[model samples]
Target: MENDQQQKLISELVFLIEKGNAHVSMEDAVAGLPANMRTVIPENLPYSIWQLIEHIRIAQKDILDFCVSEDHEKLAWPDDYWTEPVEHIDDQTWENALNEIKQERQRFFDLLQDEKTDLFSPIEWGDGQTILCEAMLIADHNAYHTAEIVVIRRMLGCWR
Candidate 1:
């Protein structure tokens, strides 16, 4: 049985993970970006907006899978997490990335909402990390990269 405080914490964390109170939500950050503009790398920016989106999707999926899967293999850092910058961004690929993020977000939300999930229990395979910690990490990481996407859009003069 969750106490009032535990329930409140769960609720707050879910809201933060999904809604982005202090920064732009992931949905808004990527919304309405034209396929032509998705691959444009702003001057001095290392990653195109498309690369950032794919990176976010990969990283988020890794964290979520780690939280749930007992036999999950970790992805190689920087390499597996990022895609090479491409000259063209296909509309189907862009939509799939967006859909992947939403699906992963929903999975994390479901885990948090599960009454039987022990938020404080450390994963045996991980280094003393709890579900609560992973949830916070996902929220923070997503918020940071989502903001980067927004900045890229602004730099391209596409964000409205």
Candidate 2:
């Protein structure tokens, strides 16, 4: 990535953040979720709703970083560093952190959409693939967890 592209992406991220594009899905997914249940974890379930949000946000951050970085940490075979580790998080802290992450995430996604960078360009974090190649990789992760959050709300009897 050239310094110019990085500069544009950085500015675009700020524009996206100013536009308030994040939280659209999160708000809708948790729309009817009981405020109380936002902190609850189901039996044997290691991931909470807030944890999932944090995880996805981490992926977004790393992906965005790789888009501009010259050196990104290489991941072992079949082990993507883009994914976040899930663990119990304090309810209050999770909620606060999640909101902040959402704000940043919107910027990251918008940066990607606006970059329109070369599909053949190598991803700094990946083995040896273009940024486009890596982007397609994250699409499923976001979609899958978006569905998971939707279902979680339903399971909690909070989905309307």
Candidate 1 deviant stretches above 4 angstroms? none
Tell me the tens digit of each residue's lDDT in model 2 across 1-79.
Answer: 6768766655544443333244335556655555567556666665567656766676756666677676755445334
**lDDT (Cα, tens digit) per residue for candidate 1, span 101-150:** 88998998898878878899898789999999999999899899989999
Model 1 score (lDDT): 0.89
lDDT of each: 0.89, 0.59
Reference-based lDDT, residue 127, model 1: 92
- The alpha-carbon lDDT assigned to residue 15 of candidate 2 equals 44
